[model samples]
Target: MIRTILLLAASAVAAIFSGCRSAESTASIPAVRPFDAERYLGTWYEIARLPHSFERDMTKVTAVYTARKDGGIDVLNAGWRNGEYRTARGRARFRGDSTVGELEVSFFGPFYGQYRIIALAPDYSSAIVTSSTCDYLWILARESTLPLETFRQYKEQAAKLGFNVAALEYPNGRPE
Candidate 1:
């Protein structure tokens, strides 16, 4: 009984903190409209990202997205950590209008995180993605490598959105 109570207490505390964090992070961030989900679906190579605990020491990261019959998206994120390949599966759904680029993705049951596509190339060849918070950011491309100019342009966009662009880690080698 004591253990169960303790667990409940911990969960309550965590929920409170997460609510606060999400409120602050999601504020003022706008998701691109007239977004084409079909164009965005596919494999994306991670060129750079801000360091985070979940992806710590990870390299060669990649994310795969596919449409689910339920009008949601299946997310497959893979990477190499300490020379070992690891993967995480998640699900995502648009927070509001399907045409918007804002989504809520959940790897853990019932706990969703914000996924906002802040920038994308005209041809959908590259993109800049981030969470509700400034703590998470990613530069992704359809190919394993992105052109230097394209990479720089994405970084600048993230910086303008309040992310720490200087802290991005290029696990696949920095774009030349």
Candidate 2:
């Protein structure tokens, strides 16, 4: 009888712990406040990001944002692969269904992914963006580089949002 009781107790403990992990996953992801999309438009260098198949073996990545007449936005992503420069043009539209900091971006035809500006510097010098699933992430800067402290803060914020910070890939270390 005692053996059966202990087994039941152990199972209960495991189930409780599993629920706690799900609570962490369900925690809402936060976005930056007072985001100015106009001021945010321009060339931004990609400092780091979570590794993805599309960006494999890429370096010196950069993005340029431009406004469209329809109130949507244009995205030009460029990088160097094997000493050759490659680029991808896409479209982004603010998630009118939700907050201003949330946008939907698409590289392929008509399909979109959630993009939230989880962090941004007051002067618009730096920004960190990520997907709602915490699968895709990027650290960008108006200049070629940002302070080491800022980098750490971005990682910390991403961690709080339930992301895997260890997967971050620095394309060009401390870009010059």
Candidate 3:
């Protein structure tokens, strides 16, 4: 009886570990060519994102990138949470190739991670962005709200990029 109980406990532990491994494996994001800094430098309102530690429970988020005098990029991120304004400043620099839409952004300090522009609209109205590890994603738009058709198209593109499109959370408190 003791041996049987131990074996069953071991089996349960293995199952739990296997489930965790599978979840981690599916969290990866797809790769895309580097992004064009010059064209991408502008204001982007966050339409949706995968729940992330840095941005959890946040709403009314917007990011603005500007060309810097030092040949780098300046990043200003702002959001409204709990009826107050929240902001963070950061910097970004191209890693492999800027034209390919891949760059690393740093907020606290030298720590940086990939910021890939996977899908972009021809009119520059919206884009689907992803992180290097595929752990984070953001749907950005020039306007506070995206048209239904445009939103659908972006969702399709994000699905093609291996993102969990259904996991996206639309901005709360957005005007209908």
lDDT of each: 0.76, 0.71, 0.65
**Cand. 2 Cα-lDDT:** 0.71
For candidate 1, write residues 112-131 as lDDT tens digits. Answer: 76678888888989888776
Pull out the clashing pairs in model 3.
29-134, 33-100, 34-100, 34-101, 34-102, 35-100, 35-101, 35-102
lDDT of 3 by residue, 66-173 (tens): 999876888888886678787877777776655666666766544565566777776678888765433456778888888878877877877776778777776654
* RMSD in Å for all candidates: 6.4, 12.5, 11.2
lDDT of 2 by residue, 76-164 (tens): 88888889988877778887643357777776665565667888898999988866445567888987788888888888887877778
lDDT (Cα, 0-100) at 35 in candidate 1? 92
| Backbone clashes (count) for model 2 | 0
lDDT of 1: 0.76
Kindly indicate the candidate among 2 and 3 with the higher TM-score: 2
**Candidate 1: regions farther than 4 A off:** 1-15, 22-26
Clashes of each: 0, 0, 8
Q: Which ten residues in a row have the lowest lDDT in candidate 3?
A: 1-10
